[model samples]
Target: MTRIASYCIAASALFLLAPSAALAQEGEATPPPAPEGQAAAAAAPAAAPAQAAPAKAEPKEDLKDKPAPNSIYAEGLGAGLWYSINYERRVIDDLGVRVGFSYISIGATVSAGNSSSSASASLLTFPITASYLGVRSGKHALEVGGGVSVTYATAQASNSFGSSASGSGVGAYGSAMVGYRLHPVDGAGFNFRVGAMALIGPGFNVFGDDPTAFGVLPFGYISLGASF
Candidate 1:
């Protein structure tokens, strides 16, 4: 009877503990609830890295192969036939226009048989021309052009007897030129040229001398200046 009672008590105790062990194992397998701060952080999206601002673009420089536009030069034996100071402008690519001025004065004395006569004269010349630059290679060029030159003259004469006389006149000559030039190709610099000119005009007496012969006269010239 004692052995049977002990065996029955052991079986009852094991049956009562089995359900509690299973419930404890199930509770350990499930995760605990997160704290409030940790839950909010986990639920939100991650932050992105910061990016720098873009740099500004710079302006580009200009580089062109064209020559300068303005020039001032002195010329000898050109349209003025003596010397002249000239200003020139490039009206377009390979084309130029020029204007110049010159002045001259003369005095003479004649004596015969205790009588003397004095004479004086002055001349002003203006030249205007347009030229075309043809064949060209770095700083060297060929030029051809045509235009007209206008001249004004004044004369005065006096004798020992106090008699005086004065007169003035105007004249024009048609002129043309062909030449070679040494000029700057890009910017402001030295300029030089040599050329031949042909002049045609009517005959007249402007100075108190013989009348000028009418014809085409071939002349030569040289020039020097700065181009800008």
Candidate 2:
């Protein structure tokens, strides 16, 4: 009977010890699994920083693809009752080239030895011009150029005796001008120019009774024009 009691007590103690050993093993395994889950949670924040880096870099790259505004221009020429057309290309800053045409007229009255004579002339002036334009400010500008001015002129004269005289010739001209430019809308503009011009050189008479009489004359012109 004592042996049977000892056996029962020993069995109860072994069963309790076996349960404690199993619980210790379970505790150790649970700690390693918890550490792996925490490591994965920490790595999630690192992935967020990597995503944020690309977001910060994107705007700078996009701005690089954008284009800048154009500072150059092209304009056309228009003037008063005399109609003319021209083109100008902005080469650098405020410098450019100008080429165009103009129709001109002149008149004079002379008295020699008690004889009064009235004379009038008309011409078509073609100018192939090159100019240096200053920096444009507000609505004002200044320009100067030298070029060949070709003119075909016809003159008519009438004396107190009702007699008539007519002659035709060709001439050369040169000029300098100051102007105001107006910008009223996009792709369009206008200019007002006032200048002094000189016309000189000799040409043959296209229509006259005397072909052997060669003449040389020099004159000045006050000119105005507009541009677009």
Per-model TM-score, in order, reads 0.68, 0.42
In angstroms, give how far residue 49 of model 2 lies from its true place.
9.6
RMSD of each: 8.4, 10.7
Which stretches of model 1 miss by more than 4 angstroms? 1-64, 204-213
Pull out the clashing pairs in model 1. none
* Number of the top lDDT candidate: 1
For candidate 2, the 10 contiguous residues with the lowest summed lDDT are: 64-73
Candidate 2 per-residue lDDT, tens place, 106-190, comes to: 8999888878899998877666555555544444545555456566779999997789999998766443333443321122344
Residue-level lDDT of model 1, residues 150-179, one tens digit each, is 899999999988899999999888888999
Question: Which residue pairs show backbone clashes in model 2?
Answer: none
Judged by lDDT against the true structure, how good is candidate 2? 0.51
